[model samples]
Target: MKIFLATGNKNKIEEIKKIFSMENTEILSIKDGIDIPEVVEDGNTFEENSKKKALEIAKFTNMITIADDSGICVEALNGAPGVYSARYAGEHATDEENNKKLIANLQGIENRKAKFVCVITLAKPTGETYSFTGEVHGEIIDEPRGEYGFGYDPYFYIEEYGQTTAEMKDLKNQISHRARALAELKKNIDEILK
Candidate 1:
């Protein structure tokens, strides 16, 4: 069966593909020749955005589609960048800009607690959908670290891992929020594929 991942982010696609590797099923993405307009993520929460993207793409392509809305929410910021994490600095802000803004916003704050949240939605062409969520707790560091991963990875430090998400390159796919969410989705793969 063909499973379409409704996202243009190559990094996300790669992470998801690695987690969802399975027999007899092919994971495909926007780069796989399926052209669909970007779905507006105006939802108040990750679950809403994930479901909207998955359902829209599944219906558009008449194929089962998977989509996720993931972001880092800082405790000190009161989750200011929750759903707006992608455009925290501006609508067209780059990762560096966003990271800078995040740091600036946290100035003088002592509590650096934060968590990365991921909500995944699996949608069928018929509108049937299932949702799963995962989160990874960490602290936001003022200085960025590592040379891998994307977005807030460099600033998200896991104490237990003793490294930032970006630094845990080889171990990311095994313990990331996205990885945990996909693992939950994988548990129901048989029913989803049927």
Candidate 2:
């Protein structure tokens, strides 16, 4: 079946495709001649935002749509950028801008504890939907470390691998928040395809 991935980010699309590559599914990006309406992500939680995006796009495309709303929650920041991760620096913040802002806000903070949380929502045209969540706990470093991966990957330190999320592309598909979420989604792919 053709699964429409509701996202404007190429990196997200690429990562998601890699995650589901083994499945017999066609993963299409929203950019593939699908001009879906942009949903206002004013929800207070990741699941809410994910559902909004998926349902809206599914309704428009008449196809099963998947959406993910994810962010890094810093313990010291009181999750200041929880739901506002994509636009943390501003409405149209770039990855670099958001990372810089995060680093600036975290300066001199003793606690560097943080975690990445991801919520995935799968929606059919009939309004049927399913939700799943995945999280990866780690700490944030004061400076960037890797060149790959987007958003806060550069500073997201994973103790197990002794590398940032960006530095472990090969391993990320097995342990990152997005990867875990997609893995859970894969477990229920039969229901979604139905």
In candidate 1, where is summed lDDT lowest over 10 consecutive residues?
185-194
Error of 2 at 138 (Å): 0.6
The RMSD of every model to the true structure, in order and in angstroms, is 0.8, 1.1
State the TM-score for model 2.
0.96
Candidate 2, residues 1-194, lDDT tens digits: the string is 68899998889998888887754678888658778788899999999999999999999988889999999999999987899999999999999999999999998998999999999999999998899999999999987887777899999998988999989868888898998998898898787666
Q: What lDDT score goes with residue 105 in model 1?
A: 92
**Please, what is the whole-model Cα lDDT of each candidate in the order they appear?**
0.93, 0.90
* Top of the candidates by lDDT: 1
Which candidate number has the best TM-score? Answer: 1
TM-score of each: 0.98, 0.96
